[model samples]
Target: MKLLLFDFDGTLADTLPICIASFQEAFLQVDGVEWSEEEIEDILGPPETEILRTYTKHGDPEEAVECFYETYASLHPKVTADPAILEMLSALREAGFFLGIITGKARRGLDYSLRQLNMEGVVDWTIAGDETERAKPDPECVDRALQQFRTSKEETMILGDTDADIGAGQNAGITACAVNWLPGFTPKPLTLTPDAVFRSPEELRFWLYRQENPLDG
Candidate 1:
């Protein structure tokens, strides 16, 4: 079976804005440093500490990390899965592709998004930043997802919208599919070199199906 590992926030759902709002709220409660909309959008998807370390330089890193989660917790429940994404996920699963979630978000956030879309059992496994010893840009989590799905690297594909996510996939020797849904939202203009890049679920479908069935034969 082919494994199809997905990144939760940008690839599967539109949780970036909610996550940014959550992080900002987390900071506001602590130093009231006032994270701007641009700042919030810029800081999406990386491990929480990276953002805390980079942006919360005004405060103690330890305290800022704690505050970061507190604020994110406050807003996570309100986040919803983008419907187009959910439909694509459903179709992919139905087609017998082994599916998994590999994300920087914690288990609580993953569960919330799955529950929001009634997809608790849709994916074979999930590995969150909080659930792993190392996060994205590292192959550990991606390896775990492949182990859970029992798929080989060649048969598995990793999808996300960031360079870090691509790094993780590359580290694990999985095919990287970079979704261009929100690359501009990151801190830097993340110029990614994915094995494949798609703009929407429909585009993804065409891409995957074409790859899986290339000939008129």
Candidate 2:
């Protein structure tokens, strides 16, 4: 593929705990609502405002979003990306692939992560949560990334940990690579009919590079 679009949260980083905690805290502080872990996971890959609005009674969305980020940002030190994956991305960039992110994270969250993981050089463009009216399971974000990279759907791929990302890529007429990295998250993407499913970064790296690496054969 000439372009690779990635999902942020579970796919790139282990932000599950921090995101769930932030959601619970934001709901409690904003609307006195208590969100269980299951509820948070059900709506994990969406904009902060979109998730907040679902539980909001009389509170403002902007305020809840602010609260969520305040908590999420504080837990930034806990969030981490696999160094091997970072190296793989760098290799892809060096090989002339147009890499970008198509994530449900807000601009602030995505920016914080890109900086924290030192992915700014690898990720040439980003289509954040607030950038699109429709998120994952919809093709707008992926389409935007395709436009930015000026690549056709046949020459692009989407890699993510959830079916939503696969669905988005499918909706955009591209191959979707499902990542089964997070063990605790149930309902594997294999059942979701992804074009390809990778269990680890190493496997993905090998597969991706083999297409262009003469040494692999």
Candidate 3:
């Protein structure tokens, strides 16, 4: 593939704990409601505004959104980047593939994560949640990335760990590769059928390298 688009939260970085914590903290502070673990997981993959709308009791979710973001920013320092994934990104960049990020995270959160993870040059482009009218599960974000990369659908692949990610990729007419690489987290439906699934970063790296040199394999 000429271009590789990636998802942020679970696929590239391990931020599930921070995300869950910040989400719950925000709701509790704004709506005075406590969400169970299941409740939090069910609404994950969408934009913060969408998630807040689903659970917020107030007239507007703006305060809750602000609280969530502030909490997430403070907790973001605890999130860590996967070394193997970072290595794969470097390898893919060196191999001449245009890399981009299409994530549900807002620009501020995405930028903070990227800066903290020190992945400034790894991705050629990025389309965060606030940048697009619609988030993942809709093709808008991926479409935006495709336009930025100036690549065709057939020459692009989307790699992520959620059904929404795969669905967004497929919606954008690209290959969707799922990665079950998050440690200590298991998605509810284990049987999500994407175009491809990689269990680990090493396996994903191998597959990406193979894509770069198909004849060698």
Candidate 4:
């Protein structure tokens, strides 16, 4: 593909643990309510600010969001990308594929995680949840990337770890691939089937390589 879009949380980095922890801490601190991991995950797909505003009951949403960011930053040292992700991204770049990120994470959190993971300048473009009018499963974010990159749907692919990502890609008429390499990751039932499913970065890279070298394959 000429353009590849990725999801941030479970796809690019193993930040889900910290994300869940941060949300729980924020909710408990602000609302005096202890949210389970599943509860927090159920509220994902919006910007942190929106989620806080909609869910925080006993405190200011803005304040709760600030707390969330603080917790996220403090817990960030434990976050890490897959060892092979950097190599795969570099290979894609060398192959003239434009890389972009379409994530439900706010720009602030995404930027922080990118910095912490030493992934700054890795992608050519990023469309954060706050940047789009609607989140994934709506196709707005994916459409933004396609417009910005001037890439046709047939020339693009979206790789992610969740149903929302696949749904977004399908809604946008692009190739959607599911990467399920993260441990303990159980995606919600997918309303839309993915174009392909990969179990590892190496497997995905090989598949893309074969697509680019069909004769060799």
Which candidate's TM-score is highest?
4
Residue 128, candidate 3: alpha-carbon lDDT: 84
Q: After superposition, how far is residue 117 of candidate 2 from its true place, in Å?
A: 3.1
- Write the residue-wise lDDT of candidate 2 on 1-217 in tens digits: 7999988787777776888899899888987889898888777767776778766777887789899989988987876677767877787788788888888887888887778766676778888898899878899998888778789898899999787899898888998988866544443334478887887777877787776685866
Off by over 4 Å in 1: 37-79, 181-188
Clashing pairs in 1: none
lDDT of each: 0.75, 0.81, 0.82, 0.88
Residue 72, model 3: lDDT of 83
Q: How do the candidates rank by lDDT, highest first?
A: 4, 3, 2, 1
lDDT by residue (1-217, candidate 1, tens digit) is 3888888777776667777776776677666678887877655655666666667656676687777666655666665556777778789888988788889886766776677657688787788777788778889888888778777888888888878889899989889888865433442345767898777778887887887888944
For model 4, how does the per-residue alpha-carbon lDDT over 99-159 read when each residue is reduced to its tens digit?
A: 9999999999999998889999999999889988898989999888888989899999999
TM-score of 4: 0.95
The C-alpha local distance difference test score for the whole of candidate 4 amounts to: 0.88
Query: Would you list the clashing residue pairs of candidate 4?
Result: none
Q: Which portions of model 3 miss their true places by more than 4 Å?
A: none
- Judging by lDDT, tell me the better candidate of 1 and 2: 2
**Candidate 3 similarity to native, TM-score:** 0.90
